[model samples]
Target: MHEPIVEFQNVSFSYGSRVALQHVNAVINKGDYIGLIGPNGAGKTTLIRVLLGLLKPSSGNVRLYGKNIKEFKDWHKIGYVQQKATTFDATFPVTVEEVVAMGRFAFAGVGRPLDHHDRHRIGDVLKMVGLDKVADRRVGELSGGQQQKVFIARALASDPDLLILDEPTTGVDVRSQHEFYHFLHDLNVHHRLTLVLISHDTDVVSTHVSRLLCINKTIMDHGCSIEFLLPSHKHNDVKKNEQIFKRVRHKH
Candidate 1:
């Protein structure tokens, strides 16, 4: 069997006395599109933070590419697209190309200038995300969806093997969300990019993600999306959402 690309073993975390995560264990294999879904305040963000090495687990371990996350120094191999509200700098005057180029700074060493290869990669990423036409536009001037795409492009500019996104489709129109997911699906199948996504839209998530993880302080459920759609589990509101996703997916 192939080794897991990301794994959490009995991981737990808390903010002061309030426990946020409790003995969570999961393994994400290569090329898996895993969806994390739950109601608000379910420690989804905390889990993502642990994977990113931004928050150390109070107990247990997080491993990336078969190594301890703390010992993994090559952060560039893991791309991240945080919630739009968390990272966008609206007043920044940088162009889309400039913003995407920032991804290389982590590898270029401090104060080093971008080389021709870096510029070429930035252009390629912009084109891949359909933002080449606006490459010269100031990032602050773009629409919310465009800005979100630029953020995704920036993450891809690093040529990461795995991409983690937190609520990537938020605030976008339905069409844009569909386009983005389609793009991600192609990236996963064609480029073999492993994707880990967290979203509140359970309906849409069920349609695109191969596996679903319902998290609320701990993992409520973790398995293939088809298991979540079984008739025995189809009565709850959340399950209804999953059924709707199945129907919509079939229609497409």
Candidate 2:
């Protein structure tokens, strides 16, 4: 019962002289919905990149599905929606179907056309994300929120057990933000897809995630969201640390 889907053991990373992360130790168990929150310049993104194997740690190890960081493979098992997925020019010609189909290719490999099963899976994910109606439309023509939905559909095309998204609702409208979170809820609730959602929006994050990891070059605090923000005097130290989060968010 000690198995974790993802593990970071004393992980640290530096961009040359600038230290981005420091001794980050964490574990993502199966079926976890984690909200990784921190202020700007915090190591949230750095930790994410290291987890995805985009950046090698200067020290310590990261493991995916219990494999050692250096030995892990099968990256297609995890889906990632990186920063600014909707920043493309409005004239870009790729259709929504084409964008989602890219995820199929990621799983099936280069030069392999979609078979019947692959096409069905593609259609199913599009419908699940509520983008089936606009499958033929140009992805760039959609609203920022709709485009982000397409990205999620693409990420789901592979039916990954784990999904990682960075600022998925960054340019989305307020209403769309709720809708997107609803879709995420469905994924985590119905499909049991584990998630690591990285954002600076504390209000939105604290509500959705099962666990909250507060990071700032290192972890400030982490635990269940309810207890993490509770007003209990017995947990005064934890409350004070949460105050640092509030101060960081309020500092403008």
Candidate 3:
């Protein structure tokens, strides 16, 4: 059955005087794969931070799974693959398996070693993301696309119901990007994962996402992917290419 997984109610946020998000309201339902798009400094990342509870809304409320986000604690149910994961140092010397294993720490606390179940789960997630063969290889040694897969495997290790990704295709090759999109679609169809993906390219995601939310500090528009790119809404396109992508914060 469909249920609201994440909700924003008149949500507003500011960095002292500068506003990042204003009166944003949205209902994210189970099995809904929404593509969040916006021009530079449009608070896309800020909204994500708010949803993840990294920032508090200046007004209104945010909820996850029907509970206020501030009070919700079942973090393992929500998985995140941050944009910075691609820039991880190749010289760090950690193996792919070791990095993916980091996801287990959320369930088993720090300093605890993996038991048989944990190891098996790690292998399963690795295979799910097509990284099992390279499990023993140094993460830094893998190509950029392969490294990105490792981080995705790490996020899926928790078997989250909702998966959030920020610019997941950044730095990936064209072929790898298409593969990533297909993988996400498979996850949505087979695993019934509710996804929130932030991307700069509308054309790329228009074919895959069910919904599109266009924002510029506030929601300029939102609707089905087909309706979003219509002639009437074409003005919202910040660029035929990428915009001045920046995550602005309301700093005191």
User: Best-fitting candidate, measured by lDDT?
Assistant: 2
* Alpha-carbon deviation at 15 in model 1, angstroms: 0.6
- C-alpha lDDT of residue 211 in model 2: 75
Q: Identify the runs in model 1 with alpha carbons over 4 angstroms from their true place.
A: 85-91, 221-252
Note the clash tally of each candidate.
0, 0, 1
lDDT of each: 0.82, 0.84, 0.81
Q: So what's the TM-score on candidate 3?
A: 0.87
Question: Which structure is stronger by TM-score: 2 or 3?
Answer: 2
* Candidate 3 per-residue lDDT over residues 216-251, each given as its tens digit: 677753342333333334467655322212111110
lDDT of 2 by residue, 28-49 (tens): 8989898887777888888989
Error of 2 at 129 (Å): 0.1
- What are the TM-scores, per candidate, against the unseen true structure? 0.87, 0.87, 0.87
Candidate 3 Cα lDDT to native: 0.81
Error of 2 at 234 (Å): 24
Off by over 4 Å in 2: 221-252
Q: RMSD to native for every prediction?
A: 4.0, 5.8, 6.7
